[model samples]
Target: MQRVIVRSSRGALPTAAKLVAGIGLALTGFFTASAILPYLPAGTRDQGAGLMSMSFGWLIGWRVIGRAPQATMAGAARVGLRAALWLALTVLLYLGALQMMARMLRGRYHGLSEALTDVIAQGLGLGAAAVQLDVIAMLFLGGVLSAILSAWAARRWQ
Candidate 1:
């Protein structure tokens, strides 16, 4: 079984570029969602869901690389780590852009406390523990979506 897995991964070597492109495409999707969704109706955006989706997509990319023909478990792990790094970079860039936009449009954010409160509200809502569960569930759903896509890409590209 292990040998079979190894052989399958080995066959996926030529698709590295494809994998990278897919990740890029996924990130583009995430940014697009983030930029446009916030402007919609109050309940429509669901920032927690968006975050979850991105996280899932990132994991999908990792799994795709892992299942590639030439990839070993270690290689797959590395791919996952790299994907995570890229995800972090993407988040930082997005947040920075948001801050810059906010500064230009509004002069300043009211303060850190206000920002924190807003974040908490978005993630945890007004209800007690229910909001937290919703956020977690949304995030999990996002991850599942990402993993499915990544795995599909890997299989298709191979």
Candidate 2:
């Protein structure tokens, strides 16, 4: 394989913007957890990944509504890609925090293989202290609806 160098021509993120985004993302997780966890079935309430749906909603809300709808096809596609990327970033941050909390609460985890197995099993066995897809699926749908409403609000008020 050949190696290639990559460089960013665009400037680094502004300090104030970085601070705001970090605080916003952190708050998103906290807000989502506080608001949604109690309503979830007891089995999957602790899994913070579910918070991504709420994060997605808030991120997409601004991205989708902030952009002008009259853009060219390519521009629209670019906006969509950015929206997807925002969701991915949100998921990573939220899950990373959750994993750290889990480790702190549970003490040291086992080897890599065991950790992976535990994650998979937790995903499969919500009734036994793990994540479940069904809950996430519903949460994601709720997020989409939330994004739409937020977009409407953004457009109407801003």
Candidate 3:
């Protein structure tokens, strides 16, 4: 015989772990975006970029990392690293697509396909410009800190 466990809507209620993780990663995203700003080419304008990144980070932390099964401290660290990479990639893709759209609006691209393809190029260029030694160090440290906090919250609250 086998037993099945079912979860209800009530199970979806927010927990301390989720709140802690979400806020921790959200701060990380905001700081990372701020770090990237100075590296952007002069006259390159961005609106609400920090807010966008923070939202993504919160989503990933709350929905992804928070919901992930608890494990050993080492495993929690891995989850944090994974979340960091996801945040970085998601932000990169978003920025790329945004730049592509801006260029299209200016009639810089000829065709739709060409404009879409340039999204990757634009993202890569931004990554290249933004990824300095200090930025890399901050990102690495921030990810680790967020992970530790989330794991601690899980253990303490559970």
- Measured by lDDT, the strongest candidate is 3
| Per-model lDDT | 0.44, 0.43, 0.80
Error of 3 at 9 (Å): 7.9
Per-residue lDDT, model 1, residue 133, is: 39
Off by over 4 Å in 2: 1-48, 109-158
| lDDT for each residue of candidate 1 in 9-70, tens digit (9 for 90 to 100) | 44354454345534643564365345534333343324353464366444445444334422
Q: What C-alpha lDDT does candidate 1 achieve relative to the native structure? A: 0.44
Predicted candidate 3 versus true structure: per-residue lDDT over 1-158, tens digit per residue? 89999877742878877888788889888898899899987655456779998999898888767775356778777888888888888888888888887888899987888998998998888888888988777766676677778778888888
Q: Write the per-residue lDDT of candidate 2 for residues 38-131, one digit (tens) a residue.
A: 4434434355454554555454534442333212444444443444345534544444445544654676665666665555444334322213
Q: Relative to the unseen true structure, what is the C-alpha lDDT of residue 61 in candidate 3, on a scale of 0 to 100? A: 82
Identify the superior model by lDDT, candidate 1 or candidate 3: 3
Model 2: clashing residue pairs? Answer: none
Report the Cα lDDT for candidate 2.
Answer: 0.43
On TM-score, the stronger of 1 and 3 is: 3
